[model samples]
Target: MNDVATPHDSTALVTGANKGIGKETARQLADAGLIVHVGSRDPERGRRAVEEIGGRARLLVLDVTDPESIAAAAHQVGDLDILVNNAGIMAEDAPAPESDLDAFRRTYETNVFGVVAVTNAFLPALRRSPRPRIVNISSGTGSLAWSTDPERAFAFSRGAGAAYRSSKTALNALTVYYAQALESAGFKVNALAPGLRRTDLNERATSADGDPAEAAAGAVRLALLPDDAPTGGFFSWDGTTVPW
Candidate 1:
């Protein structure tokens, strides 16, 4: 509702921001002059991330799998103009049939249910803002059509395990449902694929070495979208629409 842009006053909360793309997202948002709250399950790591950003970026304790932590985080952050649900886990093992069910459950705990918990917990604060935005950090593998399409490059690859991809698919669905609900409420809710980047989630030694800063750019763009920006859509780092 408010068209005024106040860099110093705009508040943002980035979940799982202690490292990787989340950390980079926090750093970039801080540099862009927004007050960023770096959320991490580990206080020490969160503090370290904040120090690395070196500005008004504060550290907040948050574990998406823990409902209490999510509530506590919402209470701590208070009102927010942007909420970036960047926290997620990947399946380290192989695909389904060979994948560990426990690992799959754990992945869902953070990737699926965690997103629901965190978003619901923060909806009140988000509603208070004139221009509220929610960006769910998703992956390209999550797109069933894209991954299954014979013409798609990813389809030819078999490295994409099942749990991680399925969880992201569920996340994309969640994004759409939330976006529809918030349509009349005046908020933008969408999911974004940051592209493959080298991060601990992929086992530090195994991931592709891409700049996390570059990956976070898409998230920052979605988070800072104007009130009129489209919601309930999937997008890649370059702002191109992604298949559901």
Candidate 2:
């Protein structure tokens, strides 16, 4: 394992960091002394967030779904120690028979394809870091084990968000694959179930009372994990393991 430096000199990029959990994760990482890149689709929002997180914070105008944007952003960052894939979209998918295919396509475009694009684009920079960490912001709803439990809300919803949930499940698969492939290279790739935080991801999340900062703290924990820490694992906000 390569443990070369601490957050004091590390650099991190948190996608969709204009607001919500992404923003909080960037803030906390910056507070921990990492040079943080607040990535947002909107330059104005991203700049505003950078200003709010003044210390070692810079704005990165990134549209994860856009190939040009991802490539440009990756080219701009010469080196990176941490990557937090926090940009995701949720759609209110109906039951299997009535669900919209377009919704599924849109959801996968951002939650799954977008992550692959961003990660691959930044691979060169991340490889340059002695201790590289990649944190994927996933949801507990994506857990096949938990979703099957009768007491779980995901089960109760009867596959209401089949598209979004399945996309996360795919993301979990990607996490494991990336970790296995990069283990020898000293990269820690993991997924985080941030819980149902108060964010604008969807109507339910916006009305929810969970603190984005609390969930973001969990993400930061994964981002700065020690060299020997577990990789390709799903963890909750409190640092406990979650079933795949």
Candidate 3:
């Protein structure tokens, strides 16, 4: 029996819910008794996911990179309490000098700009709620502290993942800005480093990369944070604070 009653008649939308972490996040949120909108760029895929979830999960066709798609999806979501910006891409893991401008454009189009577009479009619906929450699926690579630390393993390649890494950092900035802007209105906006889960974002991520559900739990926690919870914070899947 799903007994967790989310606060304030909470309703949510999880983007990129067709597969991987996004799908898992939707499942958990629905399990928590919230009406979850499974946002996907493809209607068929979204339908499949909604079938898989088999709860209060609705299908929403949203392509974050497209203005029309974002606007249309927002129009349908009349009252939303949670917004999970989980759609992202890693075009190429090339170093700064070796990276193509087009690749960076593609990465930022989804990872950075997409979040802003979706958030702005949903602001009206979110504002109608008594307690609104926004969770950005960011990465640890975005943390300047970890990036600059010479001791970190990934620090070995100072120039690796120029496109994807920087996009996440930019996402982190947006999280902070959104949190500050919406805090007064009872909105909790935060970024999460779900870790390098075993997803299709890259060729190397396989089953060994880790379970996507593990990371998705973090999104749910952020979405359900209490009224006194801190906003504009970066947190790990384990609920520990991540340095910005």
Candidate 4:
């Protein structure tokens, strides 16, 4: 990994930042003058994204699924002002109910467990910052109340992906638990649903009028929240609070 000094006193980390909403979040953060670390499992892609952002953007090789990589990235980052848990995977296809449990396990390995690993690993660095924030890139699909609604649009498309949706639900729980634990410690931890952005995760162009940049805005807002902002809450791209 290529290690470099942070250009600003406030540093932010965005996992899966090589592309999609993650990349857009990194770019916007960097543009706003934060020292942004674009985390990617692939070193080449991470470096290229940092270069493209063209500011205080740096590269950190982080594969949330790997413990070694997570630890190494935490050590490399030293101190951080923001942590965006944006890396996640969706199953390639819906598996039979009795089919391989391995597929569901693997999805959780990255979506749920990875968040725990990365957040714990980076806690020390986050605590060091005067204004620390943790934003989990969650989904509207994770909302049991919404996902089960017959009239909800996402419910129609998200019904088949049990592994992915369940993993995110677990992630939402994680966000609240951590937020409570860190509430007195002065860190704002929250989850954000980027809406349906056209990204590789869905294998389709983001729905009409969907912009990854628009989705990233919510994450950026949380990452840059004032010290008095609310914690342990779920929010949407437009800043509306979501049910836990």
Candidate 5:
């Protein structure tokens, strides 16, 4: 009795898909009929996630910070239509003027460098797809416009997490560059802020308002964007454009 025609023979790769927002995104995409590659640094964890997802879900052992791992993953999962750069980390203890330089370096290594590495490694596969899409899981903390405005939501709390915030800002910049470069090829590269949800990344600081699926809404929408969808934009969970 299943009647919905699945969206082509497209495949999606979601990095850090073993848990949290990435996992939710994978589930949504798989439900939408896209073959989803759940990328995790740990193969066991990736396998577990794939098993939990049940259908059209495969494991991809990928450590974004490791060039060899990225290259190997690229080779294994060819012909990708979507790439979700959701792997990121923050030095929870480090903040502001006293933030540890080593911590900042580590954060950048994963958040910034890792993204660029994964994106480049997957470029060939992405280029081959009819409607290539890249979604970077960004945050409001990275919004330069909001962080600087005293009346804005995150302004008061912007003093902390320099490493994480700046890394996402750099990620936003990367999105713009990639979008511009891939425009002629019909690729859509955009950044999305999943909002502060209850997740391991945030140490579950907040209560689960509902389900983790709530946070993945924006990313899911961006991942399955239409041909005419705008590229190089930052959007919130409800689809409102975020200022740079």
Candidate 6:
């Protein structure tokens, strides 16, 4: 493993950081003294978030779905210590049989392919860091193990978000594959389940028990892990292992 560094000297890039869990993750990371790049597809929003952060946070206008944008972002950052893939979309009521192919395509575009593009783009920069960590924001809904459990609360709604759920499952797989491939290079890659938050992605539907800030904790924790920390793991906000 590479030598671990203090947060004050490390740099991090968080996609979809303009709002919601991504924003909170960026905020927390910056608070810990990391130079954070707040990436958003919308330039104005990105700038706004940077302004709000008002410290080491900078605006990175990035659309993970856009190859050109990903390339430009890669070019902009000379070095990176941490990468958080938090951008994703949801299409309501996209169950099987009657599922919309367009919805599935759109969901996969951002949740799956977009991650691959962004990760590949930033690979060089990430490698330059003494200790590189990659955190992919995932969801419990994506857990095939949990979803199949009749006792799980989310299992009842499992049939509903086929597109979104399947996309996250694929994302989890990507995280594992990347972790395995990069292990010898001293790169730590893990998937974090932020849980459901009150965000536009879910039309602001939130659980009273859920806190957006709390949800972001998992990502932030994984981002600053020690060199010997476990990679290729799936974790929840409380640091518990999440079933695959």
Best by lDDT: 2
RMSD for each of the candidates: 2.6, 2.1, 2.5, 4.9, 3.1, 2.3
For residues 1-244, could you state the per-residue lDDT of candidate 3 as single tens digits?
Answer: 1122255457999999999999999999998888999999999999999999997999999999999999999999888999999999999989999999999999999999999999999999999988888999999988888988899866887769989999999999999999999889999899999988999988766555589999999888988887878889999988899998
Model 4 per-residue lDDT at 197: 86
lDDT of 5 by residue, 93-155 (tens): 445787888889899999999999999999999999888889999988899998999998667
By the TM-score metric, which is better: model 3 or model 4?
3
Tens-digit lDDT track of model 4 for 10-109: 8899999999999999999998888899999999999899899988999999999999999889889887989999998886447336435888989899
lDDT ranking, best first: 2, 3, 6, 1, 5, 4
Best by TM-score: 2
- Measured by TM-score, how close is model 5 to the native structure? 0.94
| Full-model lDDT for every candidate | 0.88, 0.92, 0.91, 0.86, 0.87, 0.89
What's each prediction's clash count? 1, 0, 0, 1, 0, 0
> What is residue 14's positional error in candidate 2, in angstroms?
0.6
Candidate 5 global lDDT: 0.87
How high is each candidate's TM-score? 0.94, 0.96, 0.96, 0.92, 0.94, 0.95
Q: What is the lDDT of residue 57 in candidate 1?
A: 94
Candidate 1: minimum summed lDDT over ten consecutive residues — where?
Answer: 1-10
Better of 2 and 5 by TM-score: 2
Query: What is the lDDT for 92 in model 5?
Result: 61
Q: Give the backbone clash total of model 1.
A: 1
Look at candidate 3 and give me any clashing residue pairs. Answer: none
Residue 38 accuracy (lDDT) in model 2:
95
The CA lDDT at 39 in model 6 is 94
Query: Residue 30: error of model 4 in Å?
Result: 0.2
Candidate 1 on 99-133: residue-level lDDT in tens?
A: 88899999999999999999999999999998888
Which regions of candidate 5 are displaced past 4 Å? 1-6, 204-210
lDDT of 3 at 72: 94
Off by over 4 Å in 6: 1-5, 204-209
